[model samples]
Target: MIARRKVLLGGAGLLALGTGSCAGRRMWLDREPKLPLGIDAQGRALWSNWSGLEHAYPASRAAPASEAELAMLLPKAQAPIRPVGAGHSFTALVPTQGTLLSLDRLEGVVSHQVITATVRAGTKLSALGPALAAAGQEMVCLPDINKQTLAGALSTGTHGTGKGITAIHGTVTALRLVLPDGSIAECSRDERPELFHAARVGLGSFGVLSEVTLQNRPLSRVKKVVRLVDTDWVLGQWPALASQHRNAEFLVLPFTGKSALITHDVTDEPVRPRGPDTDSQTLMDLKRLRDLFEFTPGLRRRAAQMAMKNLPEEVAVDEGWKLLSNERPDRFKEMEYHLPIEHQVEVLREVIARIERDAHGVFFPIEARIIAPDDAWLSPFYQRESGSVAVHAWYKEDHQWMFKLIEPLFREAGGRPHWGKLHSLCASDLAALYPMFKEANAVRRSVDPAGRMVNPFVAKIFG
Candidate 1:
């Protein structure tokens, strides 16, 4: 029996099929169920991924593991079949009406070579990090948040603030994708290359991403240094930093006149070190308090400026994974765009001007990053060397105005929006941005002809 009744938060008792302690059960007798057919697991006003500002309550959610298990459940996939990982996305890309695919059971190292591993689709990045470091390796790069699932992060091309490297997908040499028909495939640069391109950043339109074969290198120690710099001077020095550092970027505090410059690089070969994060709570609290202040309207910006001006200088060194990831306690709405790498400073100048002139009501820091182009069809940096700029606001604030102010600025500069980050582009805009947009859709059609893997957003963008 896969069904068991448990008391929910309120007086209500909800029955979660296929996920109780007895998930180990085989076939159960078909029988009428008392609980409503459509509901989420744990049922706490759930949304897909952590792009907290975008979605609220999904119609339903599902957590499945194993190829045969996911195949058995395809017939019941949600209308949008949006797969979610740790809710890390900033967009409604995983918005769903029927089912939400959770890959929690499909976790841990499935198979491994000395350097590489074949990972399950539903694995969380936090789970992946410690495991690899124990084996004397670490993920090449990671976004600020590490809670996202591997499949979901790569699906939307989540990135870090690296200089020459693309996002996590850049290191993927192979993929094990599940077609809508439940057939599993393993694709790589040398074999089934076309499928590899299409699936690398598939946006969950092709099928469930069952597993990924990643290209990993030997893990080595790294040094992370964070310094305070004037925004003007940082921009002035962009050229030199761009050339010298493997990972270099700056975090700008709006109207604060200060920025946090960060650089991470490899050191002479040594095992990475780990220790307590003395500043962990302080950092988390700082982010959380900023979001709290953002709700008070006119007071938020003033407070943000004061807070930034008073911040003390900080610098640290730690394991590559430990220092690269942050414990994100604040939740906000966000939109990020990839523009030409050379225009990074100029675009930022214009954006800053708009914020100052139009009284743009955003308090979160503006993040600038660089990415070398890749062959992934849906990749934001496809065929273009690019610099990405991300903007955010507290979730409680009115975001439509924020989106309106930034969308045109991005378009005028030939910007491409991050698939997982917030943006307001339709199919036509995306079609113009990538030549392979059509080809990617073609591959999806071939793999999921009936559109079983699609949701409304996926349909609207690619149909």
Candidate 2:
């Protein structure tokens, strides 16, 4: 069966080689956004997010090497003191004309107990995996993309798929925060419990996180599997699929009737490293399909269906941390919402229908994952198991259609928007979704009376 599937995939690749080259020129002519320059007028450098959607020319950029230095700079620094990670967020979270703070200097493992590790907030997840492995431990879960800093991921409630595994902040036992007033506070369930819950997924609005203590476990190996299946069939099996695997998620290819089902399970097998990623090549192929047949949905769907049939499943065996995350090089703007687990399939079906009917220019696959609920006050998954659905648009494409067609469906299903993604919700809309909205705001005001850390974007959400 594997040999036959490989032959079919090889044939499809040869066909794509001939057709894509002929049509590549048209794809390039589709009004891609020009890359911005590094420096701006007045000699200040321009800072842009990974997606090139949000940018700013800050008056000052500071990278503090120690927690004491960060605390000293916070109170006296200019207003709108925004903290930046890898600039991976698509929202306006990091843009600031005042002060831009980077904690990259104060990074890495600080200390470790029996089953816990104290890591600096600036540590990136990509580096944290191997660092933790060296100590014979690993995190409970990690997001699909590992380029984000630990602080950035926790601030936004980033998560991975698993029935019992919660978001990254769910594993955090304690944290040290530098308030806008330059005072340092250590918070946990025992001391300052309100601050602990509210600041767990604080969106960098409460304060800048300095160090976090995570409750991790001994490192283990896992087997990763990837297969293509019919979208409708997989939707029917999603509940069972999620329950059966240790980690499971799926990507729905819009216009086409197929989906990619990926699963990771604990195993004692020998290590077999993941092969060179074909995700980028597959993405461009889908874009070529859109470019060639945007006006004709039937032809586009038929072509995609034919190309994906009988594709061999990809298999890999490695440490859980290594296989759970991936390298995402294609830049795009995204919006994701977490809804009640029962409402996921129904809402997803409607989103696909609308995208195919109204928005024909979109070619990026829709990602769906499951996350267990946690106690963090501002977390989107607070107190309810959730199924998250994310939609993406190539950086150059207009994403206004998401607000019109996709967002309403998610909102109608009692969904909460991701903090780091694009959304049009104001304070009132958010208050209706999160039960602890008022309490979280109260905590923020207590810590930042002058609103030194509040930017225009954050003000709109927290007001």
Candidate 3:
């Protein structure tokens, strides 16, 4: 199960990926009158692009510089407005026909109370990490990629690979949001408690998030020990591996049963020699080399297995944000589901068998990780032990065949799909899995009754 990681290494900032999904995204680039008097030009008001899919609204793109600007914009905003950060999520959470706001210039670290950071919604995770490190602090957890905005990550419960910790949203102690009625409010456990719980992982369905206060930790380097392990060994030792590392993830290749595990931990030893982040080009070259000879999937799989043999033993470095994240250059459609922690390995094994047997025409490493439950109302890991299984296929692959073949297995395992990734689950599907769905909806109703925060995707899941 040797997993290829080009998809995981692409770093933050979706707009820069130039995958061309947001081609109409240029509409908001023009100044007012052309923008404000009526629905604007070249770009749709709001849209979402991940891998390669787009859903946009004609009048939904709006960019507000301050809370006051956002307040003014919301009242005038069309009914289906939504705020966007870096557009990194593969989900349709941001697309709308009403108004899509970008807070690109609304970034900066506002206040630092020791380990706590109050940052504007527009701040990028990449920028936040270095700033926090300067203050001797760092985010406790983040996704394998750091390109998302602070507010966006929290909104969708974006997570990192860790045993007991939930996603990065779990770090939020407080938040400031603009309601649908153009009113602003601050939420926290001690503040507006109900709003705090729902809005923490609200999936941009409450209102425009203005700013956030993150609970951080002192900056420290992690020791990443990379090793090659057969799939059977990893499966048997997964429980122990989960206990051994603070943050752990494993990738299993499609054709081969061989697997490789990447483990990261804070270490006392100084950094060691590390390689560049771009390995996809090299792998692509290797694949092209063998494919010219008309190699079989089994042969291609063996070639990948051989590549890992001489791989670097460990990457020990003092990378602040860089070390904690990945650069996903390869474009791929992804669907991730979270089930009870006990069910993770079993679901994975079955998924592998199905893919291997059906030859579903999907290629990429199936990612597996563990995340403990959190109190966030809409978080998939809420109220139970959780395990996240990510099913990804290369962009050019036939998704219809692959996704069709995979969906049934996930359903049988009682898996909860990540809100910002891909999923077929609707409100009924989500409602049953998360008993608090109605309660979370209630919290959302109190804040944004106008549904200004919704788009087609959000409406399907939350309405």
Give each model's whole-structure lDDT: 0.70, 0.88, 0.72
- lDDT tens digits by residue: candidate 3, 1-463: 2223342223213212332423234323222221232224655433446455545655646677788988888888777777788877777887666667788877988999878999998898888888888888887577777788888888877888787777887888899998888889889999998988888888888887898988888788877766667898899899899889988888776665566687878777887745566546633533332232122456445554554454444464665465767677766677888878888899889889887767534456788888878888888878876888887755545466446777777778888888778778888888888878899998888777767677778888975
- Following a full C-alpha superposition, what root-mean-square deviation does model 3 have from the true structure? 8.0
Output the lDDT of residue 306, model 3. Answer: 51
lDDT tens digits, residues 1-463, model 1? 0000110111111112113433223123112222332335656354534434545456667777587888777766656566777777776667676677778888887877888887887888888887887776677668877888899889888888666677889879888877767777779888888889988998877778888877676776677666667788888897688668767888775654556787877776454443344333433333333334323434444443444443344444456777677666655678889998888888988887776566434546778888888889999888888988877765545567557677788888999998877777888889999989988888888888878767777766785
Pairs that collide in candidate 1 are 49-87, 50-87, 50-88, 51-89, 78-99, 80-455
Total backbone collisions for each predicted model? 6, 0, 18
Best by TM-score, which number?
2
Model 3 residue runs over 4 Å out of place are 1-48, 282-312
Give the higher-lDDT candidate: 1 or 2: 2
Model 2 per-residue lDDT tens digits across residues 194-226: 999999998888889999999998898989998
Q: Which residue runs does candidate 2 get wrong by more than 4 Å?
A: 1-25, 28-31, 35-37
Residue pairs clashing, model 2: none
Question: Of the pair 1 and 3, which is ahead by TM-score?
Answer: 3
Alpha-carbon RMSD of each model: 12.5, 2.8, 8.0
lDDT measured at residue 189 in model 3 versus the true structure, 0 to 100: 97
Of the pair 1 and 3, which is ahead by lDDT? 3
Over the full model, what C-alpha lDDT does candidate 2 score relative to the true structure?
Answer: 0.88
TM-score of each: 0.82, 0.95, 0.86
